[model samples]
Target chain A: MWRCLLLLCFATSAAAGKPDPQRQRELRSLLKNDCGACHGLTRKGGLGPPLLPEALAGKSDAELLRTIQEGRPGTAMPPWKPFVDADETLWLIEELLRKQPVSMEHGG
Target chain B: MIEINKSIDKSVPLLLLLLYLLGNVCLAELRGSGDLGVVIERERGSVLIIETSKRSILARVEKLGDLSHASVVFSRDQRYAYVFGRDGGLSKIDLLQDKLVRRVVQAGNSIGGAISQDGRFIAVANYQPGGVKIFTSDTLELVADIPAVYGDDKRSRVVGLVDAPGRQFVYSLFDAGEIWLLDMRDPSRIEIQKFSDIGRQPYDALLTPDGRYYLAGLFGESGLALLDLWHPEEGVKRILPEYGKDDEKLPVYKMPHMEGWSVTGNLAFVPAVGLHQVLVIDMLQWRLVKSIPVAGQPVFVMARPDGRQIWVNFAFPDNQQVQVIDVEDLSVSRTLQPGKGVLHMEFTPRGEEVWISVRDDNQILVYDTRSFQEMARLPAVSPSGIFFTSRAAKTGL
Candidate 1:
């Protein structure tokens, strides 16, 4: 019952939690710089594996979501949950999948 | 007979005129490659051959594959630049002709490379096949391939590959946490000396100015592994082991590159991971002396060529701000906001001026080192590494 309640709560937050345009820009920069620090600026893979759509094709959404939240322990991949909330992480992952600008007007 | 003689005389004059023009074209005023460099246009898969003396670009060579993480090593003569592209494309670019002379895809994924001490070989560190590939510097032909094989059929990613004095190449194995010295003095009789358990996850490393000590920065742990090239029997020793233990490990937005770590006298200024500070280490003792507060997590803590000042650029949000650390006082002397996405900075060969690449602004801003005045600006497409021919003479640039 608690798990279901939490899932519903998360769903509601995710539905209402589309980041503002400015926040979207910040997220984009983070994806380019912060994440790019390891995964590479073009997402071709450096110390970490590639985050490009083709690279992420084999990995499941759930797996990526968990990795971003909890972080890979042994590797250089740090837990980004402290900076990015669950809802934003999902949006960022979706942005990576789309491989397009995440601004509201351009998302379509 | 008179008509034929007239035709022959006219043809002889025309031939003489053509020869004179050809001779003039061949004997154009000679120039030098000392001030020439190649600026990487990371996003566009192209390179701009730039001249530092006049602060201008000579030519733009394109179609270098996947340059998102490109690194370059100049030929001994500095006339040619061997660019190591992210997608394993090794391109040899001629600065004088301004063309891609040769390109070879030797690996699946390569990080960076180094020119051998003798400049005869180019050794590349690979992440995919997890080994080092040595090529003949002249032809980019495959000469030797040393796999970082350890612990089962697992091959560790090679990082921190630098040529030590005398036909030697030293590098760190990322996955295996080991350092290996490759002796190619006798190319046919290859010898490898391995140092196991030298800390964890050495992301990158750099050799000292004199090429004596090679230090590898640990990402998995807080310490840096130090290896003295003079004495391999002593093995690798850990330094700055407790740096991270003091503070709660902040999220490292970007990994601090170890390539351009500044060493002025006995002091080495290194970017402390996951923090807004540059750790100053006493090279003589290989110990952390002090941590100077900065604008943000320093990316490249590079010293000026003359070793008077150290300029540091940060990571991500704070990357726009470059702080100058006075080596004498060990304090933050000044900060300059050189627009957004300040990716990399390179001081002129003699350290008179600096050229900074603002990726977001799409401009290379030249600044006078002393006055800190904007000297000139050149347009580019997402420029990253600004390498001068000066690196050709220096070891492990």
Candidate 2:
């Protein structure tokens, strides 16, 4: 019984890692409107630092995720943990790494 | 007979050429003559001149500098638009010619601006270096600069700048929590009226349609600071003092946009900060009448020109939806999913249709107000605010 429970936990964790269309759409809107309000709508930088791939090239994925989750202290960048979860932050980082504009239709 | 026929043919060719030239000129004039509007393309640092009659984008004028939180006010003739950009670049664009007249980088960082009631001067509220700069509307030349000094050389950032009656400009100092009125009747000599301790951190403000009152939203605390422009000697007073005091405050994702509050008839639909509700206030008494629950934090509560329905849009995750509330019933008439990143909405002069900017989708969606049906979509680049020329006729836009 114990062995079976451990296997189930591992399976559920793996499934959570998979992409979710609904969550992707939510994150897309958050990144575009919330983050875009400070950073440029195109991520080219406005009141906040640029999130374009080139501007974030030197930073590692973990560093980006930490910034998105924990937020930089004493900066305009707010921790999105209240709105976004750990896995969603990871997914968001992946999408940001790809440097592709979110498609409205697909997200909807 | 042959000689006469040759002369007639020559005259006919000349007549045709003149007619063709006349037709071209007429077409050009027609293009320039119409109900004009503009959409601020935030990221691209451009403005899209739109002909509202045809529901089409006429031209996209670019290179206006940093337009992150840009705002536009039109000239008296409605032929020119002065754009105030976040990076302190003020640009004047000629609507008729669809070109930039002149642009000046006046400050390090600026929020927004206002034009004088007489259309003679334009004033910008600055964040960096903390002052308000007044410029000549036609020439874009600096006429006066009023530094927001709180005490002994302590500069405070100015916000919520608006034009009032009597060729005056009113703005709030964020750091000082004070409101100042600048009387600019004489360009060289300016009279300043300062009201201190108006609120904790006044963010943005707006003047009533009649220019009777100026309301400023406070960020550091709940409620707002109200100044009866007609009676400035009474000083500023607090309204809705207990708005967020009784409840636990939610983290505000974005400040509630006070400029877009809907004022129709006796009621004003004001967005509640950090709440998914709109506080309806009786304009006559200036008291909160009711709190209407919405989908999320309301960013803009706009009333159709007819004053029958109020349209509300949200910030961030809830920005995808726009809700229309019937004035009589005080209930949501319809909810519209206008696509992702809905930023701003503007109605036609007659209030027949509303143009909404969906920034993430990069399109401006036009919807029929009565039917609540999508009519047209014009492509744009990260569009934000939509302003109509009719606003030039209003007291405080």
What docking grade applies to model 2?
A: incorrect
lDDT (Cα, tens digit) per residue for candidate 2, span B174-207: 8899999998888789999999989887877878
lDDT of 1 at B159: 92
lDDT by residue for model 1 (B152-245), tens: 9799999988888878889999999999999989977879999999988888898988888999988888889999999989999989888878
Q: Could you give me the TM-score of model 1 versus the true structure? A: 0.91
Candidate 1: segments with Cα more than 4 A from true spot: A1-8, A11-15, A20-26, A53-63, A81-85, A99-108, B1-19, B26-29
Q: List the residue pairs that clash in candidate 2.
A: none
Model 1 superposed RMSD (Cα) = 3.5
State how far residue A26 of model 2 sits from its true place (Å): 8.7
**Model 2 Cα lDDT, one tens digit per residue, A6-105:** 4445334643785578877777867866876766545655446668788888886666766887677644466788888667777777677787544222
Which 10-residue window of candidate 1 chain B scores lowest in summed lDDT? Answer: B244-253
Give the DockQ of candidate 2: 0.14
What DockQ do you compute for every candidate structure? 0.36, 0.14
Fnat, model 2, is 0.16
Binned by DockQ into CAPRI classes (incorrect, acceptable, medium, high), candidate 1 is: acceptable
